[model samples]
Target chain A: MTKFEIRGLRADVLIGAEERQEILKGVDLTINSGETHAIMGPNGSGKSTLAYAIAGHPKYEITDGEVLLDGENVLEMSVDERARAGLFLAMQYPVEVPGVSMSNFLRSAVTAVRGEAPKLRAFSKELQQAMGGLSIDPAFAARGVNEGFSGGEKKRHEILQLELLKPKVAILDETDSGLDVDALKVVSEGINRARATGEVGVMLITHYTRILQYVRPDRVHVFAHGQVAESGGPELADVLESEGYERFVKAGASQ
Target chain B: MASPNLGITEHSHGAGEIPISKLDTHGSFDVNDFPVPNGREEEWRFTPLRRLRGLHDGRDIADGVVKVDVQAPAEVSVETVARDDARLGTSFLPTDRVSALAYQAFTEATVVTVPADTTAAEPVFVRITGVRQGDAYGHVLVHVRRHAAATVVLEYSGTAVYADNVEFVVDDGARLDVVSLQDWERDAVQVSHQYTRVGRDARFRSFVVTLGGDLVRLSPKVGYTGPGGDAELHGLYFTGAGQHHEHRSLIDHNVSNTRSRVEYKGALSGEDAHAVWIGDVIIGEGTQGTDSYEHNRNLVLTDGTRVDSVPNLEIFTGEVEGAGHASASGRLDDIHLFYLQSRGIPADEARRLVIRGFFADLINRIEVPELRERIMAEVEEKLALHE
Candidate 1:
């Protein structure tokens, strides 16, 4: 089984001209294969910071942290190397790539990850099946990636990547934000399918517990003030959903 | 225009509100008749006169050697006749001193002619290889007769101080495509003029690809002998350090119900890389139904590179179709690069993909698949140098 460990992860937002703001202040987390860990937090709680830090975003500088994938220091690896090492991040806001068709981009990504280009017919069939499962139009295979796509379409694209890349560890940040009830179910079902593979460890970052009804998490963590303030099982999510984060906010404030 | 009215009486109207000037673009082909350029004339302002290898200042050198090879289908005819051949100057006269001098110096002219009412399934090929550094004058003529269709490819290579004139006379109902590829050696200098005359209902398409030479300037002019003619000019170029590539085109809407479109894309990298493109369209008096649009976009891939783009349209009649022009030059899109890199693509590969995609739209328009693949491969090779 795969293991992803984030220890004492203190990171900061990189501002212009050597300026930085500490965002994730000494956060710690651990996720293992075949498990879903949902990160629920308020705005400005640095939940996304932890996800970006683990994914090695250029804007998020890990001031004091070590992210390990199977004991390999991910902080020392290049972005692509980290990906090749089985780490994936479903960005809250995916960047648009013009003139690159979806098929070409996914094929290239598959080639890079697999170290060999897949056979054309098999890859095409796989892509068509995956896209069909997501209810994506077949015509999107030829369109520019994320160009002119709606917010929900962009989110669906992210889940599609998560399914195709099949990383050992996936950090999904706010993937359910823009999705409607139907899309949320579709996306959560996709996540469940990946988990069914028993090879993916999911770190699902969300503000609401709605998606939990579709794909239940093994553990739930309440993040506030740059760290997790409370942890429990699916029952904790029930309490948080009915009661809300005011208690956690007050508790974080007192500290 | 988005579309032209084919049946409209376009030849009876005059040019629109552009001012009348005495500077006409047509004249005799006599060497002494053209004035020596002092960099003050409109035509000579952008050109570096001293770098033209004395072809402009009445200094004609014949020491340089140039070999020309022509390959054509069996039905076509090819001849190297004296410069005084009746068909030599039918399409155009020398409008500039360099063209006049080249016209005066070339002892023989190579002519490739297609018969009337026939089509060549195979493309005619011309390869011009310059062997010496001294100045040389050259002339080429291609005539496609009535109802005939032909595609001509002209490729240049090696080193020389070369000045040449190419004339195209397309007859009524004919269709022609000419692809001029300048894959020259690094030290080559080429200054040439192309004059093309289209007949009634004839169609002409031209593509100019420039990838080499220290300094290269080309002028391709288009005019119609009768109505219902169409012309398209698609150009692509890449300039490296200290290289200069320039193209100036004049499309004279001299007949009615005529259409023209011009699109050129270029990339410049390295220090002192410079490129220039000028598109001039004139809708003269008594010509109506003029449909035209021109677009030029340049990708400035590195620092210290410069580009100049100018589009001039003079219309003497308003009773015509649409006309438009656009120009843009900048570095490759940064968001595209970051997006690709975010997907784990290396920065170099991302840049190459972006460059390839930038030129893909135009390259896809080539009807010949082999030529399209060849050009795309060449573009990839050029990108490797930058890497």
Candidate 2:
């Protein structure tokens, strides 16, 4: 079954009072359950914007397009409503909340999304298992969320949330940045574990093809100038890796 | 001035009542005799002296009984004492220290004591109410003896046109947990001071919530008198339209091996609502092995709101294991708020939950359950008023 569908997705960025320029111009994409798709793009190509717009961020205005989650209209819904409907966005730069402990934050978020209080014993057990899978210290649960954490720790924490919440569509936006080899391996492993549920669909947004080695993409698409310029099989990622985004930009300019 | 009713008094022996004109020339510590200096004065630097000048207007003393509501546990004792009580003695000062002495001359004070080596099973509640339009003064002195442990809730409410002072002390080896609630009327002006001394192996914890009053100033000072002493200070302040709340804290470590931690959080909204937090930690010489940490975090909810945070640490000895301080003032993080809202929580509810969660760590640190619940309820009321 199709997990998420984007039809004629058009988004714009308002720089100043009167400057309304297009960022994601009439893009279209689709992802099915149990499938992983990679959107490779250069800088300023609306990769993060696409993730944010799909997550219902207030700052991003969807001028024209329709986003559907299992055939349900998502643009009309609020940020949290879309989240409850199983859309999750792993932020590129997660915020640091000083006094809010990770455990308390996750508990409140999970409860709110589930519309019920999570059982204590079951929740703790699941949390412990997820933390172990991500190689995160159990003590991290007691600390504030994303406060003074390293880049690797933040990415791992994002995956920790994904593992625990088990959302249907997980949007990973540049999760591979600033990670060492070992940290990247652990993070990709965590993503694979999250996808092991079989019902979860993954959208991996990245600039480098290194992460693709661990979590192989079923389909790869080249994104330039705010829209997908080319869609092909996994071999396309390897070709882009060798030639870099210059060829794709030239192709986009010619089109 | 001559005494009118003294008949056949053989030569006045007492310090003759100075003439009202002479009283204006530095007779003791009179607020009128001393000039309200500019911000150049060290003590007056951070104080809102410009706003304080309004007290000079002919605002009469607040009259009527001030009602106090206590929500503490049953085992905790409560009592109201008269001004002449021997236990209170001359420790209670009625003078404004800045204005008229007669304004608070008729005030009654309350004293709460937890005896030595005794641990109360539940937290105690003590509320003081002020009513009418005349002056009112109150002195609260608390004594916690060695090996004693108790949580005390001191709540102040009412509408008064005068100033108030609160003083307390925690003795050696005693554990004192105090939660002070300041929810006065809009027209009221309050100046409250709380002082605590922690002795050898003793612990002192204080949680203050400021959510009311047109102008309020709370100064809390904690002194570590002996080695192995510890103190924990947590405060939360919420100010709405036209309200000004200021919190000043001083932690003094005089002995070695002492430890202290302070965390103060504030939220300000509405036009011209201002909040300030000033934290000072003084680690004296010979206070080696001392560990101290101070942090102040403020959240501004509206465009016109303002918050100023100053966290200062003066360490005299380099032998201390650790000493650090941090201060931050900004609006709520958009991503965290959006993350919460994306999960089906409305924008308002999301903001409220983030705030509630912000204080959850500090609230959970309270050992007494009853006091924790009361603090939570007070926070709820403050958030409700935000709507």
Candidate 3:
């Protein structure tokens, strides 16, 4: 029974060194455990910014906002603090950290969130089981963290983290992009596994409706002009998929 | 492609690249050949000459004293021979002023020999401790006979200003592994040159770890005697505040069917910490099927620290398997930090993990389990100081 809320979130991002561009303007959303919310938008509509802003990325400066998890201020938390506070972001482009083995990174992350390191035997068994569930090769545990991972492999690794970290709120940013049908199915299944736990509030960001076919969303929101322009039940996704975001863009620009 | 590369088609016999390559390096046994460096020469520009404690010049060289202790398996032989012994300089000659000065100053040299066709059951440990009264010089030779295999560990410690030359002669079909640990005291300064000649079908691997010193500089050079020789050079260095560490290596592929690989990693912290790595690989003419690659990486932990990494590759023969060089030096990547922190690792712990991973690759290859753990513990201790 976890509740996450974002009210009037406005954020600006630094373009180079001095120039700042406002990407998110008055974004409002709420997600509860056992519910999946699909964030749909056109290119440059600030969908990714919303995800990063909520995850506490330094690039996204929150000018005016209130993000709370269980009534605890999330926007005030540091990036790691936000994570330890049960917020996770599956980045669109997960960084490749050379020389860091996957086993070590996952263990460190789990220890930080859990406030204590799990027993070695139990942890290894748990890790092998989770990786097996995703059809990932056990050999990858010894390899550098995403050092030479393919696009789909990187996506699968992100889902693997979600399955292990078990955060209260998870934001999957473009997890379906660059994924083939087979990989998309595998990733969708991983998300569904986390969803079945009834403890994770999922915010799925995407530009397509393909992933929604596998993991149905409870609510759909159309984002445009750095804010939500339309919100409706799951049926709204069908209309938007057929009619496209042209009308929402026009309406947002007119506003 | 931007370099003036002499492809095999340009001169099939490798005539165009032979003379120019030979003229680039000037090795001498005479000290006068290399004048006193004024901190302006290409080789001395990055080094703090004044902090060298006169190891670079002839001043109070005999006032210091160094004691040597050797522990070896029963199969190996260790002896102190006069400088005039025939096998003293058979492998290579002095290439710098400090090396030549050490050659002219040392009275006796330690020679460790592994008998032909015998594999030593235990490694040979050469422990060198010195006093910082003035200056000292030393020389050591390790010879692996035909079909023999051996491992040698040279441990340097105590406080002293020292210059020395170390040579390794690997016979045909022999295998040699050497680990040179420079763990001197805070006020110690040392300049050491290591030269190796790999015979036909011989294998040579050397690891240089520099962790403690005021100013430490080491140069390791390898040359092939015949074809089918292989060499691997691995190094790790940690520079703390007010300390300087430099490593220079050269691999000479003069024969055909030769292979060489060099990898060096360093981490620097605190103010005035400096690190320098120079890798030089030369593929000479008439050497076909030569495979070589060298890379240097540095991680700067604190502000006001500096790192200079340079990789030089010269290929005269184009009909080779592969040849490449890479060098990088910078602060810890922000993206790397972000990636770790995004996973819930605290900022300080994330930094420590990244630095540990940076050196783990080289440290894991140390072969000795105890030594590997000790190195990691020492690195962690250093990380704790500034954290």
Candidate 4:
């Protein structure tokens, strides 16, 4: 059964401004439970916007489409409601909130998503275990969320949240953008751990296949001009890796 | 300066009546007793002097007796002290100083003293209420005696279009945790002067939260009297529509080896809601090994909101270890708001969280649990007003 389904999705960018343009037009995709799907795209391909739209960002108006999480229309829900509906987005640039401790933010987010307060002792033990598994310093739990953290540290924090919240559908948006080799490995391993739950569906959005080598997506789709241009097995990542989306660009132009 | 009508009315001074003539007085000074030299007056620049034009005109004191509610711990008693008492000192300008004489003349002045070397288990709450017409001048003399540590919360809540002055003296080795809440009626214009003296090795932590009144000015002046004295002044002010909130703080390190830190954060919303933060730190000539820092930050919540921050550091002797100041005035960062909203928190909730987080450092510094909770409630109410 489909865990998330998007039908006839159409999104526009800067509708009233000079850069007014249609980014996602008539796109259709579906992800089943316990499956990892990667979306590879060139620059300006609306990969990030799609992730934001699915996460119900207020700026990204759903002009014409229906995003159903577990067959429930997500467009009708608020951003936080969508989050409570088990939808998680690993941001490209995680915002830094000074004076808001990491533990507090995570606790609030986790309780919000779970719709109930987590037992303190159990939550603390679980959080400590998760931090250790991700190789994150325990001291970071007390520090402000993403404040002055390195790029890798931020990505790891996002994964840590995902593991703790246990969202049904996790959208990884450019999680590998600024990570070093070691960071990429750690982040990919964290994702793998989250995937090991075998109940949550993963939508991995990236431009590079380096991270895919570790997480190993079940399916890979090439996104161009706001729509998925091609789809295949994991080998599709290697083809794009060698050729660098030149063929996809030409094909997108013809279409 | 003494007003002819300066006497205890129906309100009791705890003790019997004391005439104003008995008080130590400062002789007549110029109309501008405190000079604000052209641009050199950092605290005077942002104030709208035009609004203060007729402030000196003597107005009639409110006719009826004003009832002030005092909420204190069971052991700590509170009663109005005589305005002419010498223990309060000559720090505050007498009620007869200009337009506010009438209000200051009638209201009873309250003094809350924590005895020497005695520690109060709970915070003492002093709520001053001004009703009816005329100016109101009430002086609060807090003598946290030697080695005595206590928390006092002074809240100005009333309906009076007048001025109020509060003075506090923290004695040697005494620690005073003061939280002032200003929530007056819309028709009221409040001009409050707060003076604090930190004795040798004494510690004074003050948190001022301003959220009401059409125009409110809070000038908190702190002086380190002896060596090793320290003070921390943290303030949070929120200005809604058609409101003007001004906060000025001065940290005077008179003795050597003293330290002072002042951080004031303000958020202005609505049309023509103006807020100002002026922080000045002066390290005296022989104040060697002194460390002084001041920071003023303002967050404009709307396009029509205006904020002015002036952080001044005057160091005479360069023998100090560190002396610096910082000021920032900016709008609510969209990126920061969006980040919080993305985490399933609604836009309004996110804004409240961000603003609350801005003052969290100062709030956490408050040692009094009851005062902290009350301040948090006030902050929540202020944020809800924006919605």
Task: Tell the DockQ for candidate 1.
Answer: 0.25
iRMSD (Å) of candidate 1?
Answer: 2.5
DockQ of each: 0.25, 0.36, 0.53, 0.30
Comparison by DockQ, 1 against 2, better one: 2
Q: Is the docking of candidate 3 incorrect, acceptable, medium or high quality?
A: medium
lDDT of 3 by residue, B1-387 (tens): 011233434322233433333225566778989889888666787999999877776774488888899999999999999999998987777877899899988888999999999998888999888865468889999999999999999999997788899999999999999989998888888999999989899999998999988999999999988899999999999999999999998898888999999999899999999999989788887679999999898888889898988787777778889999888888888778888898899998888778888878788778767778888888888888868
Judging by TM-score against the true structure, name the best candidate. 3
Off by over 4 Å in 4: A1-94, A98-157, A167-192, A199-255, B1-45, B48-54, B57-79, B90-108, B344-349, B355-374
List the candidate numbers ranked by DockQ, top first: 3, 2, 4, 1
Once fitted onto the true fold, the runs of candidate 1 whose alpha carbons sit more than 4 angstroms away are A1-105, A114-163, A167-255, B1-24, B226-228, B283-289, B315-321, B359-382
Local lDDT at B237 for model 1 = 91
Chain B TM-score list for all models: 0.91, 0.78, 0.92, 0.81
The CA lDDT at B239 in model 1 is: 89
Candidate 3 residue B256 C-alpha distance from true site, Å = 5.3
What tens-digit string does per-residue lDDT give for candidate 2 at B1-387? 111221222232242542211111222224454454555433345556555434433233535456555444444445567767665532223222432332234366666777777887777777777776444555666777778888887777776544544555566788888888787777666667676778888888888888778777777877666788889899888888888888888787767999999989888878989888888787766569999999998887778987878776766678997899999888877777887665455677678767777666567777667656876787677667766
Residues forming the 10-long window of minimal summed lDDT in candidate 2 chain B: B1-10
Summing lDDT over every window of 10 consecutive residues in candidate 3 chain A, give the lowest-scoring window.
A52-61
| Model 1 agreement with the true structure over A1-255: per-residue lDDT tens digits | 998998888989988778989988787789999999999988889888888777777777888978989999999987777877888888888877655778888887777777788899999999999998888998988877787788888888888888888899999999999789999988888888889999999999999999889889999999998988888899999998899989878887888
Off by over 4 Å in 2: A3-31, A37-86, A91-168, A173-199, A204-255, B1-109, B161-165, B285-287, B315-320, B342-349, B356-385
